[model samples]
Target: LDWSFRTTTRAAQKLPENVEEILTEAALREAHLIRKYDIPAALRVNTDQTQTVYQQGTNTTWNKKGDRQVPAVGIDEKRAFTLVPSISASGELLPFQAIYHGATPASCPDRKSPFYTEAEQLGFRLEPSKSDTYWSTMAMMKSLVDDVIAPYFECKKNELGIEDPDNQYSIWKIDCWSVHKSKEFLSWMRTTHPKILVIFVPGNCT
Candidate 1:
């Protein structure tokens, strides 16, 4: 569950002193469980959420040599959102969710936009935070599990000829974020999804 960052700048993140030991044990346990349940490659999913901006541009520009002053187009980093992307070990890319920064449904872009239409046709989703931050909320987490995660498992199960996909043993790897580790969330998953084993990536590992 190491996040894949595209930016070149190195983040000042830290890791535990016993990271190697932790990773070794986790890896061993994961391998054992995967083999034990005969989990399909399509069911081993790793997902992550990242803060993203609306426009992608650079502040650097080629200017006159030794110019007294120079300026570059600014990137509107303020218009930010959260992107949740998931992928399976079988190299299948699931439809990602985009949580726009807003407190109401109106805050999101118009559904009539051609871009939105195309994205929707591809099973993409555009959600409103309905909160101060664009980060994923408890409700959003549920939506992600129900709308994207569960359906994906069901589809894979069908392909694997599983008679009971809802109860099939699978693995979902994610970071130990607060919302994800919440007692309520865990209970909901236990009660609603008896299977779909949740695994946490050691904090600050990468």
Candidate 2:
């Protein structure tokens, strides 16, 4: 029999213990079967802040005297929101958060609306600063590895009868594309414990 484990950055960090502990428990539970790893939450950033120009119409008109004409026409400048990496608890990578980052016009006629009305209803603005996006992703990833994965293995150490730290068996099934994204966590696993085996599973193969 084969079992698969999936997690995203957010869910990873939310684990009760460190990664090792969770891994150990999972290993013990499925010791009789083959284990496969899958991480659906990994994301890659393709673009940064992009610029967009928008035009607005103002209501400037001449008064009764018509002495002079008022300048009512104007253009509004808007910028494209940066795309950032995000992971869902179910291991889904949501690459795009919002479609637009500028104001909406009352009379605007556009088939596709970039703004996410649902998100706004949830009280979250779509415009996220570039630095915020970068730091948030990194922080969540770090927490998942350090707090969830690590502790999971620790809990299973005794059950696995893994005396030697280096020979311990711990297989990781992550998206083939996410191996690079999780490189830092993998490295940490090897160096910090030295005894645990951190195998990377590409794709969904069990």
Candidate 3:
């Protein structure tokens, strides 16, 4: 059978040549440092965010013949959020942080959402973006550190009996998102979470 297959190129291809080199060296250095410092797997964590739609899409659904629609009622095509999750090398999963669209949630209407109560019960935090396009920003990065990462770090430190602020360091591997590498954010992270060793993967290389 003669047929054609469509292929889509990824944005990662446009990344600079230095990106791979940087990523390779960073990973090697991180591994070396971890071994040299005897850092436990429990403290080595990697975090990433994935876009999630209010409604999930599927293919090959069971429907009446010639029917184009699958009847997804109340599905907001425009509504979306990012699910940021962290997992340590030792398999410890941290509570997810969700970035939702809007400056502030409308309590009356939003609180009634079916996903609202369950999201809260699962410890998913909803943070708003000024433009409703929830790209990570310096302020958001700071908020994540302050509201989520910092407290988690403290608790893990205490639980692991990892005292001595110097050796209490944890490896935080995050993608090299622009905001994550911003000067203001870096400065703030360094000063605030001195025990956290932040490592950035190649830009868009994830």
Candidate 1 has an lDDT of 0.86
Question: In candidate 1, what residue range of length 10 has the lowest lDDT sum?
Answer: 70-79
Instruction: Choose 2 or 3, whichever is better by lDDT.
Output: 3
Cα lDDT of model 1 by residue, 1-206, tens digit: 89874545556778888999999998998899899988989999999999887776665667999997777555445677899999999999999998987877787779887688788877887899987889988989889999999889988899999877666798999898999999999899888877889988888786
How many clashes in each candidate? 0, 25, 0
Off by over 4 Å in 1: 1-11, 56-71, 163-166
TM-score (all chains, Cα) for each model? 0.85, 0.29, 0.74
Q: How accurate is candidate 2 locally (lDDT)?
A: 0.39
Q: Give the Å shift of residue 50 in candidate 2.
A: 26
RMSD of each: 4.5, 18.5, 4.8
RMSD of 2: 18.5
lDDT of each: 0.86, 0.39, 0.73
Candidate 3 wrongly placed segments (more than 4 Å): 1-23, 56-78, 107-109, 165-167
- Candidate 2 lDDT, 1-206, residue by residue in tens: 59665333232334343566655665564443223322111211111122333553334444667566545555232333333333323353333333243335322224356555554453332432334222224333344345444454554455445555334444333333442347675676567655434433222232
Error of 3 at 143 (Å): 1.9
Q: Report how far off residue 91 is in candidate 3 (Å).
A: 1.2
Ranking by lDDT: 1, 3, 2
